[model samples]
Target: MAGPTPDELRSVVDRFPTPPDAEAFGRADELLDGTYSAIAESWYPELRRLATAYAEGDVLRESVLEHVEAVPSFRISEGATPLTRRREALATAAETLDSVAEVSAWYDDLRTLLADSPDSRSLLERLLHDFGYAAAHVLFLGASSPEQVVRRLRWAYRTVGVRIDSVSSEAGTERTTFTCPYRDVAAGRCGKRWVCHEKLDRVDDGYVTYLRERGIDYQRPRGCAESERCHSSVARDGPSQWWPKTPPSAVEREP
Candidate 1:
């Protein structure tokens, strides 16, 4: 059996994250400036909470701080460059893509410490749903057609380095055929034991909340672990329950 060549690997690595279709999905440019940071800012705190719950205020909680601090922070500011121009718009998109990569790597860090914990996947899934939920508010804000929803979702996962191949409708519901987010992470964990099929798209919580806002409910018919390709479908709403729980703001604002 031949392994992937350097060029082959580079091609796959380079392919991620083609920008969302602007006409179908709305305000992707809107995401570059504020939405990416807002999502991470929300995500980081909730992740900390989940970790604390897992650590239960023990020494492991202190290790959580060190582990978190190891991942560099991400923030995108409004530079002198105006997004109206093609180049600047592309730059912003590129930066947003980078931000997604940073978030994914941060989750990858958690896999080591939290993988063995029974409650970890559920906590992580809730946080992922919240990430997609926040993203939908901005990325798909003005777009709601079925095609647009699919495009928005593809873009959402692409930002996190997951490639979705196609979206199809069945029984009045839409399903996406895509690679699992854990495909890359699997080699690091499951060798012959193959404990992942049971895991079934822990990262797809984003898909559920993201698509649900668009008025769709879903079913994932195929969850096979032998191959990286997975047929996935979804489920949910945003955080009135506060989507994985956030701390109250220190200051109240004017209406």
Candidate 2:
């Protein structure tokens, strides 16, 4: 596949899907931003207490606090752009962190601290929903070419921890099918893998629909959260031939 040109990349980036509650989520983040410092002040000490209890020392505890404290406000940064425009926010947040390991540790401690708070749990769930949208952003977007689009789709799924166990193509057709393991959520080690089947289906629908809308035929025949496993195929002409086999009807044709 060819590398995506700047314009082509922009075209794909333009169509990224926004979470259903994006506006509400953005407002919540904005409100939280105003109180984040106070929240951190109130909570960091408690986190430190937990750290001590868990045998984590001041050095490591302080490191976590510093990282969280320095995080940029999590509001939807691109107000001029559609709410659908979302990848930059996640990518920016990712850049703010030192490493993937740091991200994992930060969340692990936060979850531990908030384990007993129902209100906090609800807020965390919203954050996670948005997180999934960001992780799967590229799957709903366009690409420089059909081949590049497929490449982007595969890469996006992998980023969300969806392993592509196998891939094969049918002869004379640009159709390619990828089989995935049965795990429903692909949140990697981020600890937010509790996403529901509904959300997973939405992601799969968006991916397949985006391909179809852009003239690349495709279908998602199975969803890991709802079926035996996740499976999706793309073709050049259309998805009709890719549908599951069905027995011929007993009734005669109108020939």
Candidate 3:
């Protein structure tokens, strides 16, 4: 087959599919490894330019690290299919790049410290002498903080999967409407939470309707002024009364 055109290569990389099984994960890994390697090799000059910009100071490194840390981790279930594994791997790579940015920052800090303290610890001096050049090379060439670089990294990390979009409101008559996605409620195993940031005309009716429409299962906020008027408990109400009480069903009528 003829080699893929630049646009074709981008299309393939930009729309990475989420794998569905272990076999798929392996396939995706191979594909990504080959594709990224090729791109990096072909675009060595551009990559070098970015690296030079990043090595100039800490701003780029900090920005790149911040972006990396912001990338979310995929949830994998028991007996996760190849697709899940692939998605997890991509996410992990993105995370690792973020970690690399952090390490780069540490390296920069160490250099600054060494510049100020030439007589620093022997161990520290030895370590810097060992890895300083390598660290500089990575900072300048591997991860740049420009928008284009960051965007490309993000694209490389996305799983080839469906994207979900949701919209919700905060008013209506329903009581409870929010639901928690965390595995352990007591220990707060998950960092997710349903927050009602909307200001409704009526706290109960509008809020309930909003929650119901959104399929959120939640409870009233403790010490809420409108709790007395709400049918749900004023404090510590159950999920049933929370707005957006459950995940929305497409076939079912909107509450």
Q: How far is candidate 3 from the true structure (C-alpha RMSD, Å)?
A: 25.1
lDDT of 2 by residue, 30-59 (tens): 433432333344544454443443242212
- 10 residues in a row with least lDDT, candidate 3: 242-251
* Tens digit of per-residue lDDT, candidate 1, span 87-153: 3443444444443343343344443333323244455545555664566577767765555655666
Q: Which of 2 and 3 is ahead in TM-score? A: 2
Per-candidate clashes come to 1, 0, 42
What does candidate 3's lDDT look like per residue over 182-244, in tens digits?
Answer: 212232321111111111111322222333333432232222222221112111112321001
Best-performing candidate as measured by lDDT: 1
RMSD of 2: 22.4
TM-scores of the models, in the order given:
0.34, 0.31, 0.17
Clashes of 1: 1
lDDT of 3 at 119: 38
Off by over 4 Å in 2: 1-146, 172-196, 221-229, 239-255
Alpha carbon lDDT of each predicted model: 0.42, 0.38, 0.28
* Candidate 1 local distance difference test against the native: 0.42
Which portions of model 1 miss their true places by more than 4 Å?
1-125, 166-172, 184-186, 190-203, 219-222, 234-255
Deviating ranges (above 4 Å) for candidate 3: 1-30, 42-47, 66-255
Candidate 2 has a TM-score of 0.31
